[model samples]
Target: MIAIRSSVAQLALLFLAAAGNGALFVIILRLRFVMEQHLKWLEQTYPAGHVSARGEQWYNRPFLVRSLFQFMLFLAAFLSLILLIATAWTHRGEVFGTMPQDPALTYYEEHAARLADGYETLSLETAHPALLKLIDEHFEGETLAILDVGAGTGRDASWFAAHGHRIVAVEPSEAMQTIGKHLHPSPDIEWRLDSLPELADTSASGETFDLIVLSAVWMHVKPDDRQQALETLVSLLKPGGRIYLTLRIGPSEPERGIYRVSEEALNTQLAELSLEAKKLDEQSDLLGRSNIHWVSIGICAATD
Candidate 1:
C-alpha cells in the first residue's frame, strides 16, 4: 500500500539524515584537530629554528586544502539539512513549518471517535514507572480539567478519560494524533490539534488548564529557548495547578544536555520564573540507560 511505502521512505530518509549529520560532525572534528596540529607545527617550525630559513613560509602551508575541505563540509551541511527537513516533512503528517498545525491532529483519520477500544490504563506496570507515579501524584482523585500536551496516540489521555477526570488531548503530529483518536475516543476524551508552544500562545490569548502534562517533550527544545518556555508554562497554569514532566539527567542526550540542569537547578529556575515546585521525585525510565529522573512543579502567576 502507499501508506506502507511512505512509512518506509520516511524511515529511510531519517536514517540517511542521521548518517549524514554524523559524517559531517566527524569531518568537522577532524578538521579542527588538523588545524590545531598545523598551528603547533607552524609555531615550532618558524620560531624554534626547526625549518630552513626563508621564514619556513606561507607557500609551504596547506591552507588551500583546508579551505577546500571547509567549503565541502559547509556544502554537505547545507544539503544534509535540506534532506533532513524534506524527509521530516514527507514522513510527518500535517506539519506547519517547524511546528505542525493541521486539523488531522484534532481527530481520527477515519473521521470517527468510535474505534477507541485499547485505551486502558496500566498500573505501576509501565515500561517507565516514573510516568505512572507522576500521573498518580498529580491527577489522582482530582476532578480537575487536564490537558495532555503532545498526547501521542492518546495513551495517557485515554487513561485519564477512563478515570473520572475530564481531558482535552492536544497533539500536533497528524500521524500520532490520528492513531490517538483511534485509541482515545468520545465518552472518554476530546482531542485537539495543537502543540505546547502553540497552546501556551492560545493560553496567552486567553485559554487555561488546571493541570498540564508534558512528558518527554522538553528534551526537544533547543538549549537557549527552554527557560523561556518554562516561564511561559508557568504563566499558563492555573493558581493551584501543576506541571509533571521528566528531566533526563546524565550524558545520553549529547545534543541538548540542557536538562542536565539538575532538579535543584530546576527548582531555582522555577522560583525565578514565578513557579513553585510543590514536590519533585527522582525516578528513572524503563531502560534505566541514562539514569533519568523527573521534577514535577506547580505554579501561581505572581512574583509576590
Candidate 2:
C-alpha cells in the first residue's frame, strides 16, 4: 500500500512537470514567432541604422541563443515524459493494483483516536471469544511467543501480554501506534511499525512465533495478494505454531478498503501453505451490525 501511494505520487508529479514544460514550449514558440514578425516589420519600415531598427536587432536574440533556450525547454519536457513512463513501468504492479491507496490506512489515520477509543471500549473477551477459546485449547499452560499483526491500540496485544505471553505488535498507522503504546505500556509487548503482504521489519528481525494473530486485518488485503500474505504469515510461524485469524465477513467497503472474505477462499490459502485448520467457527459481529459477521479460523503447521 505504501509502495502504491509513493508510485502514484511520483507519477502525478512527473505528469504535471511534463505538461507544464510542454505548455511553456508552445507558448514560447508562439511568442518567438510574433516577436520575429514584429522585428521584420521594424526592419522593413525603418531606414538602415535607424534607432528603431537597431533596437529591434538588439531585442532579437541570436538564432543560436533562441534555439538553445527553446531546446532546453523541449529537453526538459521530453525528459519528464520519459521519466514518467519509466517510473510507471517500474511500479506497474503497485500502481495498477486493485487499489491506488490503502483505504483502511487512510481511514485509520484520519480517525485513529475515535477508532482506538471504540476498540478499547470492547473487551478482548467480548470481541474475540472464539479466538481466545481456540488459543486456550491449543496453548493452555504455556507462555508462548505471539505476533499480533494490525494490533490496533494494542488491545489484543495487551491482553496476551497480561496473560504472561510476550507479544510483538505490528501496526502501520503511527497515530494508532502512539495511542496504543500509551494505552498499553506492557514491557512484554514489543511494538513495531509494519504491515502485511510483506511484514518487512518483522520478517527482517528473524523472529518466529508460537502464535500469529491477524484479528480483523486480512480483509484489507487484495484477493490477489492474500496468498503471499498467508505465505509471509506462515514463514513467521514456528513449526507447529498456530495462526489465529478472524475474517470480517460482510459487504465490501471500498471506501475503507474492506473486501469480501470467505472461509472457502481462506481454506484454499491455508491448504496451499500446507496448514491444517484446527478450528473454524462463525460468529455474529461483536458490534451487532446486521450486515456484518465474523469467521474465526485457527490453523497449525506440521510439527517438526
**Worst lDDT 10-window in candidate 2:** 49-58
Per residue, candidate 2 scores C-alpha lDDT tens digits across 1-304 of 5546878999999999999999999999999999888877877887574344222354474776677788888999999999999999866756886445577887887789998877998998888888777777778899999999999999999999999999999998878999999999999999998998999999999999999999999899889989989999989998778888988888999888899988888888788777777556788876669999888888886443
Model 2, residue 49: C-alpha shift (Å): 53
* TM-score of every candidate: 0.52, 0.67
Q: What is the lDDT of candidate 2?
A: 0.86
In model 1, the runs with Cα more than 4 Å from the true position are 1-142, 198-201, 252-261, 288-304
lDDT of each: 0.59, 0.86
Alpha-carbon shift of residue 209 in model 1 (angstroms): 1.5
RMSD of each: 19.6, 8.3
User: Which whole-number lDDT from 0 to 100 does residue 167 have in model 2?
Assistant: 97
Which of the numbered candidates is closest to the native, going by highest TM-score? Answer: 2
